[model samples]
Target: MSSTPSTVLDRFLRYVQIDTQSDPNSTAQPSTEKQKDLSRLLVTELFEMGVLDAHLDEHGYVYATLPANTTKYNVPVICFCSHVDTSPDCSGAGVKPIVHTKWDGSDIVLPDDLSQVLRQSEHPDLTAQIGNDIVTASGATLLGADNKAGVAEIMDAVYFLINNPDIKHGTIKILFTPDEEIGRGTAKVDLEKLGAAFGYTIDGESVGTLEDETFSADAVKITISGVSTHPGFAKGKLENALKIAADVLATLPKDTLSPETTEDMEGFIHPTNIEGILEKVTLGFIIRDFTVAGLHEKETYLKRILENVLTNYPHSTAHFEVIEQYRNMKEVLDQHPQVSDYALEAIRRSGLTAKRRSIRGGTDGSRLSFMGLPCPNIFAGEHAFHSKLEWVSVQDMQKAVEVIVNLCQIWEEKA
Candidate 1:
């Protein structure tokens, strides 16, 4: 193995330049063809790094394995996973990454757009990265640091391990999935082929966060059908579906049970989309909570609101449908507490105070846990994800690489 440190920053810069934005409207597995561009590049880079088995599958998922260098035979195969596609909410094309060398704890205004500023007050994490190199986009596009930072950290860790065979570790699997932002990240994962005992999704924010739990989620779609009549003669005969939908939205508790009002373990009922006319209207909502009971309660409350709103428009008919998205990984991770315990130990070994936290949003790990791999989330330094104001610190990312290296050692030592 080479004694020199891996160039994780360079890898990350190169990855964000590629436009790998995922599309939610697309029915394809990857949701976008451009996602394959990064997937193919990852495969090529993996092969160049001496992982001969590294290849992108038909579904644009990149899978690679690092064979164990140790004499011990019982070490469990641990998988480090991340997604390649950026969120569909923001543009990820022609990303010009700006590096702020030695951040002085000041507001960073994007070069392309001064309106897009990274304020220290808004981002408390910036306080910790005072002297570190901060990376952000040029404001025209999103910096794909969400999972790309995770990908770079994992790649650098693998490269470090490969170059230094002295660091004894068991077989490690690397998985780069697609469409994580659109929520189909692990939909096509072949667990039989992965064959790992446990997994860690290096896809969280900040420096030392080790998230073992995520919100249990469900999608609610409300469709309203109303009688349409000519406006000239529509005094009492017309029941505007748009008016009913508006009333329902206005009745939703804005002071509580909302994404803007909730924090920590609090649940939220968020309306994602609303569209329709006087004849028909549809409302899309995403419900989140830490518990199944909480989810049901929120759904019941939402239905009650809709029912009350429809009472005014007796001629209108409404249909409310709930779709299951994903459950909290805590249900699975609780059964295997060692998965997070080892990660916390690894974080301390990497010289950071490990913070055991839960994600307000779900990761690919959430779905993978239910799929039988039992995965938890690890920090990759991504901050303000899914926006033009996104940023990450080079020092924080390097620390994450150290955490990954330490995790490999911890699992082997414990085994």
Candidate 2:
């Protein structure tokens, strides 16, 4: 089964036009109401395409089951999932996508400011994309290609599967999740309802990149308290919490730390927020490492620094809390090598070489894998994610749809 670039581009544009940026602070399911705008459309489209079971759950997860035509083989139920939400880091609203009809391997301008060009000098990958129609934002907002492309591809694949029943497939499940950007996409996923032995999330970048490994992550919250006094008499009586907070912040090693300073297998302590003043202060940090032992070592290093500070400043107290966010999915995926191997062969059959890549950030697949699904991530052919400069080749986007269809066919062949 195959789809043209135009079909995939039209679907992708329609999805990106909807405002579905997730709110991390929201207390509701789906995180933001606007996310449903896309979910409802997806549900409507699925039903129109003859997927009777397609419907949105109470929490806004859209699930549809395409029942197998041939039950003799007892094929394994497989799932293809993607999130509908874009990152809260940028505006996903009012996206004006500009398609370069045929990119000439040069810099392209976004909609808001023509002066702000997505320079080829900065992105050498664009050189490989010459003569391809690239979809990009107008500089006013992010293109929402992060997972919108994923959603579009999933939709395209579903249509392809329906139109071509002779292709042979097992029971295929499709899920469009919300709030993946805020790290809660899998929170409401009913695993039993999904009924897939293993799954693939169409949420990665490039044509061949497969991510089955991710960092072990945790968040640390630190609060400091001190006695506030009048400036004139404060020299001896006051213990400035702001100063102590600065001291503690300075204690984190400056030599090799933070996301900007590290890459690949390296780990870092990223300081995300700080607030309050002289008498009280609060801080938040995200710790990430590829291995559990390394993550634990980083935690020990952080605890040691705080203990030293508390010993030096007895009157000024501090409260520290560490919460584990997600673990390395490798532990779970390693137990089921067939999941990764199957996905690899599927990509190979699509005429693209598959390369395994370790994701610096975790995915919903990480949580799902640990939850006993043994899920891995497949590429959606997007790049420069979570930014206004983000873009994706229309050719690549359609190829992703082909890959999904091929995966289903490959699974059936093996069965």
Candidate 3:
């Protein structure tokens, strides 16, 4: 039993109206208290869907269990996951979702300071969306489709399954994580307790897109220390940290080389932020690569770049720290081919073609896979994520619910 677009849209709009922007600078587990608002709502919805055990943990993770009803199907329990936090890039508060009925596929201008033309020429997919309602944000705020669409789809699928018990399925677990945008969504995830042999995260972009691979990412923070003296009396004896920081930046391959210049399988070092003075400076960068070997190569190259810069300016003490955020899930998922096969078959059963793709960034699934749960990402029909131009197709979202239902059926059949 698939959910109707009208119903999914209503749920999505209600979820986005809550402000759950995660904080990157915060040391808290969930990062923001407002995230609890959505988590609590999800808990209530799950209980209403007949998942009587639905509850939110102390860390704001909402979980529920639909115990196995079919004795013939003894497949290991499966789970569906999505994050409740929106990016801190914009305000997620007071979000006003605008629903456009029968999209003409023209450029949509929002009341905020953004204009996005779904140029029919640019997106052929927009063609399929003609006569379908699309939900977007007024240029002032991000539409929260990034993961809310995922959340809505998960909720809808659970409710649909609850209403239709004839569908053969095993135990199903549902979870809504918080602070995923900040990269710590799964840090405290109780994997042993989750009890899912494999799961799917409904957070991909395109209708057919299924991402099982992603870049192994790391964040580097470089601190350059130098002797500072009065600029008015400065001479060759004075060493400026700001100048050293500039030299280190210059050592990088090229300033223009970025995500725009890079393509598939191309690794690049992105300088995200920098701030400091003549005495000390701190520069931040994110290094991304599809393979760990390539990641190591890039890391070594960066260290060499810094050493080369240090050679140019003697006596400058440069200290750097790099922390790995997430690893590529491909290698792990590759070993478990069933995970991908189940997802592909599920999408196909939903009447949508399955297209295996790569994630430009990471998802909570990546971390979950590494944590003994082979989790691949499923699409939720949301596009232009994390911006005011974000939009989701009503029909595709309904299809996502079907896909989720199909996934459980496929799993039981295989088992």
RMSD in Å for all candidates: 1.7, 1.6, 2.0
Q: Please give, for residues 129-237, the per-residue lDDT of candidate 1 as tens digits.
A: 9988999999998999988999999999998998888899999999999999988898898889988999999998979999999999999999999999999999999
Per-residue lDDT of model 2, residues 1-415, tens digit only: 5332236788999999999999999999989988999999999989998999998988989999998876556788889999999999988888999899888876787759776589888876687789999999999889999999999999988888888878889999998899999999999999998899989999998778789999999988888897799989987678888888888889888778678889999999888899999889998889999998888888778878877976767788888888999999999999988888988887887888889999999999999998978889999988899888899999888778888888888788888
lDDT per model, in order? 0.93, 0.88, 0.86
Best by lDDT: 1
Error of 2 at 5 (Å): 8.8
- List the candidate 1 regions with Cα displacement exceeding 4 Å: 230-236
lDDT of 2 at 292: 81
Please provide, for model 3 over 192-237, each residue's C-alpha lDDT reduced to its tens digit, 9 standing for 90 to 100: 8888888899999889778999989988888998888787887776
| lDDT score for residue 4 of model 3 | 30
Model 1 TM-score, 2 decimals: 0.96
Which ranking of candidates, highest lDDT first? 1, 2, 3
